[model samples]
Target: MKVLMIDDNELDLLISRKLISKQVTSLEFTEFTDASQALFYLQELQENEFDIILLDLNMPDMNGWDFLDEYQKLDAHKANVYILTSSLDTRDKLRSREYEVVKGYFDKPLKSNYIAEIINSQQVY
Candidate 1:
């Protein structure tokens, strides 16, 4: 599984990486602090380059909503995007459904059980 995690906070970014590493051992991991750079890479990369995208909702450079907006313009649509947010608002959850590529919405500090759930749900290997 090739996963790309985009978050602005350094602590959250590190914690996510650590949690993911503990849960999923055999996979490619890429971390992006800048949403625009991640979007650029996603657009330019080959089809199916990333299996999953764990995106943060509130970012300084570019918010997760904007990331999804730009992502829709790209041709690469294989990856399943899961919004990893700290926001508990119901509106955010409802709004995510508007995007075709978004597969799921998860709360921040993505748990090991959620990681397992993601693995089981995807079954992409």
Candidate 2:
């Protein structure tokens, strides 16, 4: 599976990659520290080029919410997006539900069980 992970923090991205890689051995990752650049990449992606998108809500230049706004303008693709954020606020979780493409909301320092859950849930689609 191909996963596009957008996070401003390099450590978080590295940790997520390691954890997720351990769970999904056949995974391919495209990491981005900048949300706008990631959005630009997504704009040019072909259909099903990526299976999932793990997005961080707090970012510099463009936040996850801004990215979603632009992402919605693009033609639909098969990528299921999950908000992998550090925010513990219920309001943020509730806001994520407003987006149709968002499949799940997860906390930072992503756990192995969450990766397993993502894998299992993805297979059902």
Candidate 3:
């Protein structure tokens, strides 16, 4: 599986990569600590290049919402977007439903079982 992770925190990125490696041995991970850089990369990519996007909500320049807005414009089919953040706001969860690409929300310090479930459940197209 090819996964893209966008998080500003270096340590969090490190932990996530390690967790994913442990849970899903075959995963090919590409991580970005800057939302803008990630967005740019996504913008220039061909269709359906990424299986999933693990996006951080609270970023420095372009927050998760902004990234999602731009990402939605790409119009890629079956590309799952999961909110990977520490946010506990009810409104955030409610607002996430407004977007079709967003698969689900997962709290940061991500659990391996949850990651495994998502990876296993992915319907390859």
Candidate 4:
């Protein structure tokens, strides 16, 4: 499976990669610290290049919301997108539902169990 993670924090990205590697093999991860760059790659790349997108809600230039907004403009197919954010506010959760592509939401300090849940739920082999 091909996964793309868009988070500004390098540490979070590294930790996520580590956790993912421990659970799944033959999974290719493409990470981007910049949401805009991630968006650009998605826009230009061939269709179905990524199986899942783990996105951060709060980012620098282009936040997750903004990225979703622009992402909607493109012809990207139904790539599973999960909001991985630190915000626990109800409003954030409520607002995330507006985007049809958002498959699930996860709190930051990502747990391996949560990753396993997503993987198991999706059965993305």
What are the lDDT scores of the predictions, listed in order?
Answer: 0.87, 0.89, 0.85, 0.88
lDDT of each residue in 22-47, candidate 2, tens digit only: 77899999999999998888777675
Taking every candidate in turn, the Cα RMSD to the unseen true structure, in Å, is 1.6, 1.1, 1.5, 1.5
In the range 7-118, model 3's lDDT, one tens digit per residue, is 9999999998898888778888899999889888877777668888898999999999998888887755547888888998989988888999888888878998778767
TM accuracy, model 1: 0.92
CA error at residue 67 for candidate 2, angstroms: 0.6
Candidate 3 has what TM-score? 0.92
Candidate 4 lDDT tens digits, 1-125: 88999999999999998988888887899999999999988888778578788999899989999999998888757578888999878898989899888888899888988888878867854
Compute the lDDT of residue 45 as modeled in candidate 2.
68
Using TM-score as the measure, the top candidate is 2
Model 3 spans with C-alpha error above 4 angstroms: none
**lDDT, residue 82, candidate 1:** 88
How many pairs collide in each candidate, listed in order? Answer: 0, 0, 0, 0
Q: Give the poorly placed runs of model 4, Cα more than 4 Å off.
A: none
lDDT of 1: 0.87
